[model samples]
Target: MRRNWTDTVVAMLVATALGGCATSKDKVLPHGDHTMLDVWNQETGGSAGGGQPARQLLDARQGLRRPLIEADVQAAPANNAAYTRTAANEIYRQFHRLPNPDLVMYVLPHLAGTDPVPVPGYTTVFPLYQRVQYAMPGERLEDY
Candidate 1:
């Protein structure tokens, strides 16, 4: 009898606690005829999103933007302090890739499979090195 009383009290307490957690739907979610843009603006706290302001924004940005002239193009290379005009910076500089020797393998035609079909012989070429190596700056490479 005592156990039943305690269980009933505990169940009532739990039920009361759960019942308190039930919030009015109005309080839990926003209630109004609000557009998606209005909700987005409220959440992000940024200027409103729309195409109407794009033209004004673009026109305002145009105030700061200016077209590049020949003077601007000619001055760029001169202002660079780390590097001067060199063959390496121009067409004179060449990317000389390290040479990789070719391995020519000739497959001799022979009978294959249980049916003994004649397989025609063919020649295939492969690189001797697994990966093409690169020459370090100023590294000497001998001509083959």
Candidate 2:
């Protein structure tokens, strides 16, 4: 009986330990009001959820820079350039990363503009936001 109790306790301990390792990868994360440019700064260490790496944000920001910036936001040179780059980068980097639709929707307007594009592809008509996924242990950007 004592041996059986010891085995049961060992099994329970092992199960508990393994349970802690099971992280929810498919769970959607929160999308904050940041643009692609903001993503570069936001991803210093890891993401807000603590499960994903920060590099994803950086990559997303770089990937969408041209699309978001080229879109004409109609703001003054200073405001447009600054916000356009920042908003574009932040929104693209963090848009799809978050699980909450409310968060993504909240930042959408800020990333996009009111008017249609004056130059078609050169200007941005709709705001674009990206989603980020978590990386596994020892995983790098290429792995994803």
Candidate 3:
């Protein structure tokens, strides 16, 4: 009798465990009438056991089909031309300016090459210009 009772209790416990593993539709739907499978099928565009067409994703550029007009082109120039002449002048001045300033240097007396003759001290200037100048726009070398 004791052995039979234990076997029955064990079987009942196994059955209860298996039943607990089964999913209920209420648990998936929560507050709605639809089940988890229905929601998933709708989201993934999967036909819910029917002959319906699948939903398609839209392209990002589908709505931008308008052509540009002359007004757009005219407006563009003003947008970036606030300091056009000033910028051009500045650029021209920079390009026409000297790259390096003229430096006047004095050299001390030193031994000459090969013969080792005593060389006298002398002063010399370099660059000639105060600053290194660059050419202006469309400037010619002969212009300098």
lDDT digits (tens) for residues 1-144 of candidate 1:
999999999999999998878867788786689888887765554366545455666677899999999999988877883366666567642345688889999999999999999999999999999986767645744544
Highest-scoring model, lDDT: 1
Tens-digit lDDT string for candidate 2 (1-144): 999999999999999999867756555455668877567544553444332455665677788877445435544476756555565676643322323232322222223357643432232333343545544433433321
Q: How much is the lDDT of residue 144 in candidate 2? A: 14
lDDT of 2 at 115: 69
What is the lDDT for 90 in model 2? 63
lDDT of 3 by residue, 17-110 (tens): 9987797978965697888898777765566832232423222244555688999888987877754767566665434443565688999999
Positional deviation of residue 128's Cα in model 2 after best superposition, in angstroms:
74
Q: Considering summed lDDT, which 10 consecutive residues are worst modelled in model 1? A: 87-96
Off by over 4 Å in 1: 1-95, 111-116, 141-144
TM-score of every model versus the real structure: 0.32, 0.20, 0.26
- lDDT at residue 80 of model 2 (Cα atoms): 56
Ranked by TM-score from best down, the candidates are 1, 3, 2
By the TM-score metric, which is better: model 2 or model 3?
Answer: 3
